[model samples]
Every structure is written in C-alpha cells, then in structure tokens.
Target: MSKKTEFQALDLISAYSEKKKNPSHLELNQIFPNPTQPRLIGREDTADLVPSMERLGLIEPILVRKDKGKYLIVAGERRYRAAIKLGWKEIPAIVTDANEDVCYEMSLAENEKRKNLNPWEVGKAIQYLRKEKRKTAEEVSELLGYSGRYVKQLSSIARLDQKSVMELMISGKPLSVKNLEELLKRKENRGGETISPRPGSGSGRISINLSKLNGRVRDNFLKELGLLKKKYGINE
Candidate 1:
C-alpha cells in the first residue's frame, strides 16, 4: 500500500459498471460498509482522517453501490468511519450500480493508492473475492491489472491461519511478502494450508455414509460434525 501503483481502479470501475458516479451527500444511515474491507482499530484508526475531514470537510467522496434499500460502501470505509466519529449525519459519496467485481476492483485499487491497507487485510480481501464472489486468480489478476506472480503472492498470504498472521501483525515487525510467505510455509504454505483452493483447482473432497453406521456411531459422528460447524461458524 506504499507509493502509487499503476492500477487504475476508477477506470476499470467505469468500464465494468458503465455508470457515471452520482455524487451526493448521503445520510450515514443510508450507507453500509464493505465487509471485506479492513477493520478500523478505534479512535487511533480514524485519528488521522478526522482532523483532515474537520478542516477540509471531506475533500474526496467515498464510493458506494446500491443494495436493497441501502448503499454498500465499495471503497473509502476509513473516511466513512471518520465521518461517523465526527457525528456527521451526511457525507459525500459516489454511488454506482457496479457489480461485485467492479466494487472489488475499486477497493483494491484504492488500497494500492492509499497505502494504509496491511498485508493481512489484502489477504482476507482476496480470500473474500475467491470464496464469496467466486473469482478465479486469473480473473482477480486481470481485475487489478496485477501480474500473476503478485496475485500468487497475495493468494499465498491468504493461506496462513488468522491467528498466526495476527500474532505477526501484533509483533509490528515489517514483513516482506517473501519473508512471510516462507515463514508461514514452514507450517502450512507448502501448498494450500488453511485456504481452500479455487473451486476448479482440484476435485479433492470427503464424503461419508451415516446410514452404514450403527445408531450410536452415527449419533457420535453427528455430534462431532455439530461441534465442528460451531467452531468454524458454519451455518446449518
């Protein structure tokens, strides 16, 4: 997230959405945040933006997409949060009808420009696009206009477990993609560690026949399955 990359999010957004940005002062209630966007760490997070906003009065408009009756933030969650902290009922925005891919593209591009986004956030965002939006690595690469090697590095970041990555983040040690990649690989990144591969990446799966088991065994299996689902927050 340092130094401006060649990625042009707005251009791609215009291409995919084919809709002009409708600038408006939207009520905070009318807008929602992007789930895949990085989380803000409280006053400290908005501390920087708040002062600027107070002085400049929102020089830039946040990007958003209409969903249901509300607007979902496609980019600029940091600014949106700062406005909320300032008790702003209305903030400027550019609302669009962009699909998920376009929204994601803008998000990544904005992150590249801002340079505040961390490696963990980038990993999770990529993982979200892969799982929730069903985007392939190649498609993601093309969307960001990034090279395959760079996208592959990011996909590798997605492989490390959350706890471990968080620990490294807490250490506040600067980590290069290559260094983190190798460190995490010492455990899981040899291939796919915690991350599930792209849907078509492989045919690996597991199946069991509960009917073949006696009642007691089936009951025990189901109990374990229930526990697993709870641990992983899987919906029944």
Candidate 2:
C-alpha cells in the first residue's frame, strides 16, 4: 500500500467514529454478508483471529445495515466471523441507513486500508466495482486515489485462470507485483489458451500446444519450460 492509501484508510477508520452514532447488539445469526462484498474470507486468514477475539473481545463494532428483518454486514466481516466462532449469541454493531452503493464504498474503503487482500482479490474488487457499480477503471482509480496503471494491473490479475487463482490463494506463496506481471505476460502471449486446466473437466488437463513442433524440438522446449517454472517459483 502507498502512503496516500495508508492515509486514506486511516481517514475511513476515523470516519467510523464519526458515523458510529448508533451502537447496539444484534444476534449473530441475524447478520448476513452484503451481496456486493468483494473480500473473500479464507479459513487460513481468519484462524488466528478467533483466538485474538476471545482474548480481547471486539475492539471495533462491525458496520451493518438492516435488510428485511436481518442485518447485512457492510464491513468488519473478519471480526464478525471471529465473534461467531467464539460462540457469541450477540455482537456489537453500528447500524446504518447507507444504501447499497454507499455500503460498497465503505466496504472498499475499509479493505483498502486493511492491506489483507491478495493481488487476485484486489483485481477482482476493481473489476467488481466497474461492472456492478457501473464505474469505469478510471473512475475506480479516482475513487481509490490510485494511478491508472495500478488499476490496469489489477484488471489483468482479475483475468487469471481459476486454477492459478486457487493455487495462489491456498499455497501461501508470496505473489509480488513482478510475479503478477509475468503471469499476465504468459497469459497474453498464449493468445487465449493458458497452462491451467480446462474448464468443466473432471481431470485438470494442462494443454500444451505442441502440434506444430517435432519430438526433438518439443523435448527442448519442455526442458526450458521446466527451468522457467522453477525460476519463477511456479509449483507444478
């Protein structure tokens, strides 16, 4: 995260105090995830949170909106999940009347500062705001107060294959921006096909387009590909 982003996130955190005019308790089972939430709650990421929440209680109240008869979570999902795992019947929440658009804005604001989103998640979030909210990449960039290039990079990451994404999310591999760039390059160079498994297949088949090459040439190419994968830390 950039310094500017850090400051913006702090600004939103401070805004929480200003808008926290109504703090009350709601049944844990009554709260549902916002339909437009972009953040993915992974078990690995939230495992330690349960223990911390048990020891400290909830430091900040979750932001929620009343929908139908149930409450919809606007932000603080990690904390909310922690509270649930701790067997809390009721949890502290700040009820707000913000509409869906405003709720999504607040969710993004909180996520930007938290710095917990992986690159794929960041890309997907950017894409989600563009399509769901009908905002352009430039507009989302402005909303984030980030550069257009950064927005484009995330757009690229969002296009990665589901298999690659699943591996990245689960493997505990460090995906630097440079690694993301290389992945994008490989994707683009293939013109449409990727090394990932084909969709809708029970067995994930890695399709290599070697029909045009002879056996000797294909053998040499495979040798070089193995070396490249190791250099890039791409697990087979």
Candidate 1: which pairs clash?
A: 1-115
Residues 16-114 of candidate 1: C-alpha lDDT, one tens digit per residue: 342334478899999988765543323137878999999888877888888888998987788998999999999888886778667777877766666
Task: Highest TM-score: give the candidate number.
Answer: 2
* The candidate that achieves the highest lDDT relative to the unseen native structure: 2
lDDT for predicted candidate 1 compared with the true structure: 0.70
TM-score of each: 0.67, 0.71
lDDT of 2 by residue, 1-236 (tens): 42145423345446668655557888999998776776754623668788888999887889998889999998888788788778899988988787777777777777767776666777787888888779987677777776776777678778876577666647765665556555666767854323232346334436789999999999999899888668545576
Question: In candidate 2, what residue range of length 10 has the lowest lDDT sum?
Answer: 190-199
The per-prediction CA RMSD against the true structure, in angstroms, equals 12.1, 10.2
Model 1 earns a TM-score of: 0.67
